[model samples]
Target: MNNHKKEKGDVMVEKGKLVKISYDGYVNEKLFDTTNEELAKKEGIYNPRMIYGPVTIVVGEEMLLPGLDEALLEMEVGEERELVLPPEKAFGKRDPSKVRVVPIKEFQKFNIRPVVGMPVNIDGNVGKVVSINSGRVLVDFNHEFAGKEVKYRLKLEEVVEEPEEIVKELVKMYIPSINTDDLKIKMTKKTVTINLPEVCSFMNNIQTIKMAIANEVIKRLGVDKVSFVETFEKKKEDN
Candidate 1:
């Protein structure tokens, strides 16, 4: 895992390839994010809303942080590497201009009481309140990790090439609750037809999700169209 040596006949990662990766990201030697569930729990960063596992990313697509995304191009399947990224590659340097003072009445207008260390959204920009005094609230709009170096231990798990599996992975990425086995994927020429599971029919934001899935498939896989078929069955009641 320490030495990244690719032998002959190894499948090298390339742009536009769908690859799965597991990584642990650290800032100031403290684990900030990880793909391992147990490690996340151990580090007290486990979130119930997060799905802990290897995530698929399209190479060179900027889906990942810039540093990590560039590193993947030089790796092969099963290769592991540890790299430290500068602030620019991580979250970018902190900007003093991003810090602004707003009148406390702005918060009161929205029924909000501004408090130190509280996050707030103003004019669609997310910022954290650093201080509140004299009827003025200081908000810093820089990212929480701005101006910090980050370290990552990365492992490229698999490079997915099959069209069917690629579509399935994309679907799962958007609708994590949908079982891939329950999805019937049919590819005809340039179109990919997915018969969604029964559970998906009632899921919220399904239409939006379908549109997103279709856009990804077309953008990444060059598919002409994606069709989703949802079917409902009638139950027969007997006396």
Candidate 2:
């Protein structure tokens, strides 16, 4: 088989192909820098560490770090590339004002211990504690990786073209539940719909999660629209 043919879903391992990759990442540049290569090496990222996994991304999918995805589009099977992404292309710069002091009692409601220099998740927001005073605690909500340029050294390992494979990727990316038999998938030319079972109660706020998941899948699958439906009991119907 000619590996370069441009067929609809022909699996161009070149780009827009669903592939599994192993990659190592490093962060360096003017915006962000480690103490040194020695320190980075000690942190297990200076040397190429394996990060193998499957990803269903179209050649131009914005699903990946923009720069890394662009670089991968120019690669072939088993090809490797080292991509340097700027702050804007990476996680973006840190805002100093994101660090603020809040009453220690606010965190106590979540049963979290407010300690100086400890990391905590506040209402789904991850922040690190900078200081703890008598009643107030300083927390920085900026991402730890913010204000950093990142380098991704990646190699495409395999490309798969089967519809089932595509479906599996879609399921994994969205539901992430290993027991996929409970989830239902339906697709049309312009839109794909995912149906969740009643047993998945954690999906009560599925609308928000669904939109986020659909956004990622649509970008990779090259679909224009997607929607999700949950199979939960309706309060009105119950009455």
Candidate 3:
């Protein structure tokens, strides 16, 4: 369970690897201005929710948040530790300036009518209506979970080194454009080949995308080093 003997400068993870992890964490609900005593008293009411669960991530695939992946890189198999991540490293500090009041007419542009105290989705962003006064509507765009410090109790559970599972996880975690069954993987000593159907033509820059996916998967799954081969038909190329 304890594989903490990771050598310095070794790539902690490689492309197309699968890793399982169990993590539990709490996020402080109050902003920097709020007192710790007050925050503790409001736990579970206004306090940020503490989350714990296990999930498998394919390295270099950007499966989890960037910061969360970074935390896993230094860990070894069955390694468990409590991580105190600051706002900058966590969800980020909430910006008060992001809250603004806009003309009520702007809401209609998106075919949405402003209602007092109702939450509205604005162009993929969600915000609650704080006020409706004299043709103006006030909304706060800051993430509801922003500006809180998060604590994580995490353990690396398992790491899979096979290429086929890695490729399967890659398609599951990053390339949702392709069906898992339709995606193909072939591995040799020197290269890992990936084949996607014509339907997944959007993944044209497979090399670069695979690199990014590998980076994320490594952080989440904990492995190192991989080369990829992606092939698609000539006529189905995306313009």
Candidate 4:
């Protein structure tokens, strides 16, 4: 189940359904991000600390970029294609007014040394210092990829529909740190139960987390009541 195998059906992606997708994004033919490590390594941007796998998202949730979100509405499971997005559709065009020059003395007064390409926040605005000259620093507040075209190689892996599977997907979205294998989910006619392992239940502010999960489950899954089950092991007594 770890792999996003193509399901045999004619289901088209729509809003509020749990969706799993694998995609690779590129700018000017250079790989920037991908869900597969082998593809990432092949594209020369692999990071050891990165997690590589299909990402599950609810369509129309705005979890992805604007262009990708719009594209998801027309996608079918197991379909693969390449899409090119213009700057406006992607991250929006860069604004020249967002670029500003500041006096170097202003940074020096705060014990800060401004360097080209260093990130800086000035007057509550965040930007990268793209240049430094005599007595002045130039900052560009536009997004790094602004004005650039992007390409995405996308694959729709699965369209989750079953009640238990949908609950698991929602849990994965809410508590991603918990391993999927460790989650125990059950669905009945009017109720759904989630059993959180000891490792996940005892973390900081667990009651709040459980509350949020319950709310999401009831609101999204239409279950009348949601319950949480926590288990603790007793110490063995030698007879």
lDDT per model vs. reference: 0.90, 0.65, 0.64, 0.83
- Clashing residue pairs, candidate 4? none
The residue pairs in collision within model 1 are none
Q: Write the per-residue lDDT of candidate 3 for residues 2-81, one digit (tens) a residue.
A: 54567777556544457877655576633332113344345533344422234567555566545667767776667777
Query: How would you encode candidate 2's per-residue C-alpha lDDT over 1-239 as one tens digit per residue?
Result: 11243446532346556765545567653223232355456664453442224444555657766776776665566766766778777777899998988888898887778878799877788899999888889999998878887886667666656544565565565555435566678877777777767655565565666667677667656788776676776656655
Clashes in each model (backbone N, CA, C under 3 Å)? 0, 2, 16, 0
Candidate 1 lDDT, 1-239, residue by residue in tens: 74547678866689988889999999999999999999999999999988889988888988888899998988988889998999998889999999999999999998999889999999999999999889989999999999999999999999988889999999988887667898899897799999997779888999999999999889877878889999777878998
Give Cα distance to truth, residue 136, candidate 1, Å: 0.7
In model 2, what is the error at residue 37, expressed in angstroms?
A: 22
Which window of 10 residues has the lowest lDDT sum in candidate 3? 29-38
Decoy 1 TM-score against native: 0.90
Instruction: Report the Cα lDDT for residue 91, model 3.
Output: 67
What lDDT score goes with residue 144 in model 2? Answer: 80
As for TM-score, the candidate ahead, 2 or 3, is 2
Q: Residue 155 lDDT in model 1?
A: 93
Ranking the candidates on TM-score from highest down gives 1, 4, 2, 3
- Lowest lDDT sum, 10 consecutive residues, model 2, at 28-37
